[model samples]
Target chain A: MVWNEKAECMSREEKEKLQIKLLKEAIEKAYNNVPFYKKRFDEAGVGPEDLQSLEDIEKFPFTTKADLRETYPFGMFAVPEDEIVEIHSTSGTTGKPTVSGYTKKDLDIWAEVTARAIDMAGGTKKDRIQNCYGYGLFTGGLGIHHGGYKLGATVIPISAGNTKRQIEIMKDFQSTILTCTPSYALYLAESIEKEGISIEELGLKSGIFGAEMWTEEMRDELENRLGITAVNIYGLTELMGPGVANECMVKKGLHIADDHFYPEIIDSKTKETLPEGEKGELVLTTLTREGMPVIRFRTKDITSLNYDKCDCGRTTVRMSRITGRTDDMLKVRGVIVFPSQIERAILKIEGLTPNYQIIVTRPEYLDEIEVQVEATPSLFSDEMKEMEAIERKIANKIHKEIGLRVNVSLVESESLPRSEGKAVRVIDKRNFD
Target chain B: MKIQQISVFIENKEGRLKKAIDVLSKAGINIRALSIADTSKFGILRLIVSDNKKAKEALESNKFVVKENDVLVVEIPDHPDGLNTILGYLDDDKINVEYIYAFVSNKTDEAIVVMKLENIEEGMKALKEHNAKILTLEDIKNL
Candidate 1:
């Protein structure tokens, strides 16, 4: 069920050769058309002609989110305004969002990579795709929709929210493939039971989940609850939506579309590309994008690259699951801790709900963190001693997980806020800005 | 008799107890007996109100989590040794009281206390053997 088998199954040498040629064109296009890339390239004294081999990419300047933010609203488009057909943007927390434009051919390539993503999730033309990723302004919805259509599957553009309607349509349409964020998938799994709908009633073989960071424990929960193979799909609005990489059934790591998106791991602080298997920040270059060809864009997401061939028969380089973001990595009492690590610890223990919030504050000279986890009905006790014991158990578990002690508070049931999209779990009051 | 008490789960935030009280007050329900057990994180505010149904609805409408628990309601002498005398009966009967809170009954010169015992049925039996007067829901409504 491999989509674009020739491109996806190419040998390492062939793929590298293709990537080198595409990189030259992308660099030349970015230099010739986009003034931002041109000025930045000129200042670095690196021209398109300087790109002789793949190794020459190291000499080029790295583009960042701030750089993209500077060019808001059509400033980064490499193609003519009329040539650009589609546009998607991320919800920028700081006032204005970063926009991405795509030409018709660029849309075709988006569909192609998403098609490969759907194929990686074991979806085919016979499969019915119930896409709940969200449709407008965000790349998740339409990006996966394009892939479903390209894969020739029945794409149910159900969009997001409307939990009841989502389930009703899922059962009626007999959708075989589910696509949404991993958190949303988990919500649906829980909702299915609340609605009295058994897992066997709907035909869901696999789910392509991404758009937020989720742990392996969550994946296991989704897989068990939905009775399907839960796979991870990685993509950002800047990098052609959610078709950038996908996890095959092998469940090891996500295989990046090597020829389309040239992937590299780099030390975020040093800005130098790290060798294979070394964990660092991910930097991606859109080798074949026409509308907005990004040149070595620094994706603040933290992950590692595995160049080894996968058992799923794809030679595309795979990236380990994103562990933490360099920006969100918390330094508490000189100890580095990721919310994901704390989350892993919380989920590992029984009688604890997934809804939790981390509050970091600087009291005097020391930084303190309080992890507040919602107490489900089963976890709640009327006695103070029993409830305090629950809090202590969670705190000890977190200390063991992150190597840093934190105050654990067992808040009332359903006290924390629930998000339909990305959940904001951290409230940093350290005032470091 | 076993009286139904409403246990409200509240965060240890300022005005939380007042918020629950406000809800019950706005509903025109009279609170009979109340006790709060809390840690630094959260508190469980237990209440015996004129209308358990109405009080629960009011607090829950305000998005408070409420649990219905059973506890023995008995009348004791309204004196310095009243609470101690009731506990002596439980001790002599080998019964365990988890928590006990008292509210003066308007109908008499006695205090009606809510006893959250480890075994409600056994507590009622022991209190009955000691000739302690236990109040029912109807008696609580009248008071």
Candidate 2:
């Protein structure tokens, strides 16, 4: 079901006109109020007036995550501090977190997009939402909370953790919708099974899982185990959290809220815009953001966009599931490998847990990768040869997938660390410097 | 008779074997017989201990990957070709011996051979038909 027919189902021409109008205003606002954008525009020899059409966005320089880090806290905010009512930041696990501030109108837009997202997941005012996203400086928690409130759904702001309590409350409250990272959803499913509660006892009808990259195999697993329709929610703190785009019940692709956030796909190497259905890096421009108006913000996420109207009847452009991040790609022995590829290989093997860690090391100037996977009870046997054969089989499968021979080590069950947030899947010890 | 054997995964690094044994020794668990099958990268340290469950818990608590496997322990006379006699029975029956490790018992004039076979049940039956003394869990622990 489309959430806002006027906004989500507008004609392409009408949407483009709205986007171009807002895009010009956003650029002018950033150019006039933010020194960083002004200097960037000055250096590029382009001004806000240069944007005659939406295509003129290509003339602007790309704003990168590093640029966001350079600005640090509040440097990217276009509005005065007094007008900014809410602030959220990235986890900054790699470095400094990028801060995003929102005026009252910006918060309403956030809620509007998120409400659309929740509605696309089949959530309504009668539905109870158990939001498991963390609630601190991270935008995920509050992003969904605001959306659920805006949708007038019964919002259970349980935050995250305490798995036992989450399960208990989910049962007692009969929450109809669940929201959290996909990894945490799997963890919750495992916990629910261990707790010996039948999935039918819980009244969950759908899940809004996002915040990290997950595979289709994982989605199927969650759906089968939890007995709910699992859909992907795409968002970034720089744009707006948890609601920039969402997969409708059609589940074809995530529909971007075009009127609020303009989406573009650009070639990663060439920095040239690619046509729809062509895979490239995603660059976003917040068309209507008042507090932190970002222009051509280069989101390192890689995916293709489809402008064809979705079967769900939403005219907003849809982006394919994020395949990989440009920065997360690993070069092993001169061949590019992604953690998702390795994960897909591991999941294909029966009796193997989805939990795995890829370790890349440089021993004697040759790059070697070791995939450590947790062994389930069925896979663990006393016969050393049987175990060795299983390890060899895993190594061969991974070799077939990534074209690199890797050592497969079978670790004990539950030995690997589990994360409530994004799961760390790779450890590269090769120092290129 | 099937003997419970504890196998621990040890990275092929210096003092790793020592560290694994230390965990068991500190737990007051006695090792009856032990063998290590290793490659260049890592090794599997297999042990027949006084108590398989306790040894497994101790090693696992100390962060070792421990697995319990069933192996056949047979007593052979402490003489020339004693092991060969037991192997001949299995070879005649077409049972493949995956691996075998032996230890001489101080309490008896017999050496004990721990054998892992491709078809463990068939190998055990062949050994029994040939009148080979298969050691029970209690027999190995007492020895």
Candidate 3:
């Protein structure tokens, strides 16, 4: 198995001290290497000496999504293009996509980190893993694939779609482990039941699902349906994809590969680091990336940190399941509403489904929120009055939960578009420009 | 005879159509026939309704992005040649049909063709010259 000497047995105090050392090293690297970072640092009138302790970390300017946008394709890479072995990017709904790169050493380290994550999730070399995440520029598939291979598992690269074929490969290979998004996993389980394939008949045992937000209720449902344990994996294209963290068999929270990537929670507004267990924005600093070394990269994902030791015997700190995104938070009428909160409200409704849209429009001056929910087949009926009543009920529930009144529209099931990649959650038409 | 034609701009998202329907229903308007012209991001819902003024007011008040426009409505035979005859008339004059939609009237044994034209006045004249019936606003509402 791929293992790092420094991470495996390091004490908590040693890890913390090591992180401070690395943060200073990363700041100096940015100051001396990248022109963009240099300009920002010079303009801020800050030097390496200013970063004496973690308290001074707030002195650095917080990087925004706009900064990533300003750089565009590969402008932020600290190393030369010739040194970069691979390039990955996230798609753009508004403008050009944010690009990232990896050197050969970086890829190797990523594979090692992923392997460690797989081990944390209770996978052994004896298990045959079926990976359904998409590859190419997308990180999910290749990230998990490299990790599974490193762990010496027979990896089946069934990268997204064709659920039937995925099932066939799983059964034929007697695959014991699966790695894909939670949505796709649910879809696969539903398809298996529809096809009358018993879960017991397939030797599948465990799964690692990520790349989109899911709830605890969803995890329970998936576990019950797939007849296996499901673990949550976390990462982004900007931070080297799915291996930045993984949940242990305990499934309490995702364990961060804290040795390679330092994790900190920060107040989204003030950019101040919060104490552990306080809900805030996740900030990551890569200690040992080669191609594009990042220093204090602000990942807009909102979650808290857990330093409690796990029963699995790993000393790495864990992160709670992502509640939502700092950017994804919808500010309407001076109220901060997350789409996930609406999703939670909708999921609690007996006949409502997960497919929905949060539309924010500026008809007058203030922003108005409208939730268009898709009614499951069970909720659809011949009676028009019943459907209207259901809509009213849903609207009332949303109002009660979020403390904001919203217009609710009950759309037919499958009426909402399905995404093959990241699901588009919010549609803001408030003239953001 | 006055008929109201309304165009609504919509995105390909859930609840949009239902919201439109809700707005129209609240205004006590009945849609005679409707067509959706869709691209990826936005869709235009064009409707011929019994209460056009009410429908337009309700849509605008509810903040639905909409526009009002006029298109020539022509009555045609129910048979296949009904459309070919109209196209044949326009083709001879070198006038092109940009887009079109239709609703067949069961009792009347006729269909209505709502056509957008390159030249509206000339296109209507060419159709009238061919002895085809150009539907008035009253003709559409009665159906």
Kindly list the per-residue Cα lDDT of model 3 for residues A1-433, writing each as its tens digit: 2244358547788888887887788778777777778888889888777898866777876665567778877767888889998888876655667777998888988898889878876787888888888977888889988898888888888898887799899888898988888877877886798678999889988989899888886777788889989999999877788889988888889889887787889998888899989999998877777676676789999999988776666678999999888877888899988887887777778856566899999997878888987655455432334446777788888888799999887654455666555667689989976
On the 0 to 100 scale, the lDDT of residue A260 in model 2 is 94
Chain A only TM-scores, each candidate in turn = 0.97, 0.98, 0.89
lDDT of 3 at A334: 93
In model 3, the runs with Cα more than 4 Å from the true position are A1-9, A49-52, A362-368, A380-385, A429-433, B1-143
In candidate 2, list every pair of residues with a backbone clash: none
Candidate 3 has a DockQ of 0.02
Which tens-of-lDDT digit does each residue in A1-433 have in candidate 1?
A: 6787788788999998999999999999999999999999999998999999998999999998888889998899997899988889998875579999999999999999999999999998999999998889999999999999998999999999998899999999999999988777877886798678999999999999998888898787788889999999999888889989999999999999888899999999899889999999999999999999998999999999998888978888999999999988999999999998998988887867677899999998899999998766566666666677877888888999888889988766556876667778899999876
Better of 1 and 2 by DockQ: 1
Kindly state the number of residue pairs that clash in model 1. 0
Off by over 4 Å in 1: A49-52, A186-203, A224-227, B1-6, B13-32, B39-41, B48-63, B68-80, B89-96, B106-110, B117-143
Screening candidate 3 with a backbone cut-off below 3 angstroms (N, C-alpha, C), the clashing residue pairs are: none
Worst 10-residue lDDT window, candidate 2 chain A: A375-384
Per-candidate TM vs. native?
A: 0.87, 0.89, 0.70
